[model samples]
Target: MEDINTPSTTGLMDRPAGPDYRLGAIPLAPERFSTWKERLAQWRALRDAPLYLEDGRARAARGAERHAKRRLSVHHATQYGHVFSNKRIPRDVQAAAMGRFEADLIALTPRRVLVLEVKNWSGQLKVAGDRWVQVQRSGAEVTHPNLLAHNREKLRALHRYLAHAGVNIPAERFHQAVIFVNPRLEIDPAIADHPAVLCMDDVGDVLGSGTSLGRHMAARLVQLLTDAETNATLAENLLKVIPPTEVAAATAAIKGLRTWDRLTLRGGRELQGDIIWLRLTGNQAPAAALKPGGAASLEWRRGVIGGIQWVLRNRGAGNLRGDIFWDQHLVPGRRVPLDADDCVYFHEPGEPKPSIIALSHVERLQIG
Candidate 1:
């Protein structure tokens, strides 16, 4: 295997054929000249046109903003790579309030959901309640919208939206922070120790340290957020209501679900199943799992069908067959035969304890 960390001088095709060579060469390098020429011409046209100067400036500003966002994303990924991050959540999907209310970044772990409001403004700033007073380089005092308040509202909206969608995430598990992209920006001491606020330099100390949420909780949170069906549902719903322009702006920032093994479970339990549903309790439970009059918990499941057989092992004295249900129904339940193509639902009502079945009437086991 090639050492990815080490730089290679030779191109894939130029390297000598050997057991180490794994990639095949593509013959399209020569064809890319025309595409490059076209891009160069367009760049020259934009540079030469006086009428397009403003457009160029606007494009440059947008490019800088995107670069800053990308840098911040990379930094956070380094600090909390196990966490799931969604950037530029649309106003409608977040708060559904009037005017613009986009969240710059939203990160989720099993322990908490971090809402980060990113600002590139360069100056000294002071936080007062729900407002930020900025002193510009020109010594001019200016007031900008308070990111702390905005992020809090975004978190509130997210919790509400999740609840309405049947994906319960608690308000307490949601955290808010402001990330000043400008390194030179000085923050007032009054807000320096605020738990919700984070400077560009404080990310490593806050997220990477064990003093806050531990790595185990962070990993679990990431797993819940990256669950295939749940992520798809949330994305689909958000895209349905958000504006096209907002979608376009956020497209690059939205990350895909992280991959894991088919039967991977929390606490590193490797069980056999196409779908493994984990009923989490206490602090391990997801925000959605917090139910009234009960300890907060979350049921997380993920996997694809096939290659794994479903069965019911009878612990009773005699052999027997019984009906299987896709979901636990109040009635007798859906009757699914052992040989059917439908999914089998396994219920462990008393979790942390194994379910007892009669020896004669237990699930049959088969590999294929």
Candidate 2:
């Protein structure tokens, strides 16, 4: 929620409108997932507990944000301006029928503002008329909301919001895109080549292009800044239009959005952290003992073995390995705890090194 010009404020709009102010890179949050004491306690608790690898939808969403952040930072357009993530959707904008939402990423440059929706969905996907279908690696088909259409609506809402805020930019200057950041994702012919639907790899080309799609975008953004048209000036104008209290209100609403993985211990104690490394060595249920139905039929319980693994393995996963984040800072490396078996490394905010936890004592790990 920190602004590019100042980390103390929630939004860039909170700053005074100035013609010469500049914007800096707004990187992802830093390390220090848990307090030192909390990390020690988690380590001690896991000394004898079992580990269970669980996943959740929230975790995927958070990962997608990270992917988009990295991609945007390295792209050519980044030099033009900083990309903002989780830009809170104004209540007026939401009331105007954009629905309750937060922009996944907002690319603001001198000439244009690009609203991006980041999707981390993997596996095979296709379009079915108005609906989107997800063909899991297990061959089970799932229908998803029409995110493509929704993103367009969001762009429209943003245009309206900017107009109401008195920023007299053309509606054409605003753009929207749905970026699929997952490397494992496979798109059907229906949407694979859609202009607004892009893969992470295409981000650079799109941002740097001066063709029909970006003729008015990239070229305009690359133009030298004017004394009357600095990045801070536009940003300030946008902010100045909004009431000083508006930024605080929006930040409060979206600030505590928790995306960390949750660890629910057998003792009913829940801990928030990240699973750095994990191995699924638990015995699989016998063919006869396996549930008849898919994920729905499986009993999702804490400390139970194989339920999550079965689903992931069906989707071509042999084991689970993920980044560890403290607070929102991604932990470095994926190295396993030396000489550990049937154990996974866990990290909490403030913890420097990952703690080794036995797989037997862990009830379940809900990925954030």
Candidate 3:
């Protein structure tokens, strides 16, 4: 709960008051980096770069000590397009949308905080509701998430965390909001039972509340986490809500097929049999055929079949310019021949690496 005396929280919504919503960040360090795997990875990334700069034959190189620097982090970028897409956004753009919320909370520096997940969608945002739509300047369309429901879920998590912290807070202080960035995109409006959301146009101004904790409080909670005992207790309690990540969640998600045991390929195959650690040799093309309501087929040029994707068909031909992967290994769903060997591996993103079944034999197929 928030009072006039209570510190404000970080809000990720857009601001109209001032465009300067830039925030300062505190760095995060891993618990430990001495693992052998980490060391090997670090070595591989730096192995080819020149170690010592060329200078005079003697110890003259020492004069350029200021030039010494640490290796740059090898970034891994994931383009988030699954939720929704439009011309305003590119297919490969990475949204630090969550980061916006995180930074805002950091500035708020509250003893307890609330996170409201809001979506400003017009259509019924439920299974049996109307479809919400967002029209970009280019006349392209996108959908907003069910922000009202999302905020409620977030509030629950925040309350759980706050209680465990022993930092007593109340429900009223936390809020949620979903705003249509532009008001011109009209829609029939409605309300919900929750008090967290604020439906508006360009919520950025309200989110960047221009509130900040002084240096002392901000720095104090910067690296705060639930104490060890609290964390352990939370771990046990969380098992009840969402099943553990290992096998439970996956099994529960799939319709009737539970991946209790591993899937083994019975048919005879060569080096391409193993699903993980596959060496892909295939031609990547700007062309491939697919049905209007079906998955786009991407042809592998060579080697063991690797992977396939259902891409946005907007490339060369009329319907088949999407980036679809045709892998050799049998990925659960339907199995069809990619080459004389590989097949399609159908899966939604974020599935754990399929167990690596022990592969046998050297080779039977012609592996390039």
lDDT of 3 by residue, 138-234 (tens): 6666664455564445445444443443433345444444433223335444433233334332333323332233422332233245554453344
- Report, for all candidates in order, the number of backbone clashes: 21, 20, 26
- Regions more than 4 Å wrong, model 3: 1-146, 161-173, 192-346, 349-368
Alpha-carbon shift of residue 109 in model 3 (angstroms): 4.9
Candidate 2 lDDT (Cα, whole model)?
0.51
lDDT of 1 by residue, 1-368 (tens): 48766545555544322221111221121121234344333233222322102244334434544654555456533333223332323345545354233455555433345666666666798975667899977899888777667678877765554444445444555567776656777888776667767766675443332312343344334436667455434433432211222222223233421111122122222222211221211012122222211211112111111111111121111111221111323324322222111121222322543321111111232110
The model with the greatest TM-score is 2
For 264-331, candidate 2 gives per-residue lDDT tens digits of: 54444455555565433332222222121111111121222332332333211122233322221232
Q: Give the TM-score (vs. native) of candidate 1.
A: 0.38
Q: lDDT, candidate 1, residue 262?
A: 21
Worst 10 residues of 2 by lDDT: 290-299
Residue 30, model 1: Cα distance from true site in angstroms: 38
What lDDT would each prediction earn against the true structure? 0.38, 0.51, 0.26
For candidate 2, what is the TM-score?
Answer: 0.45
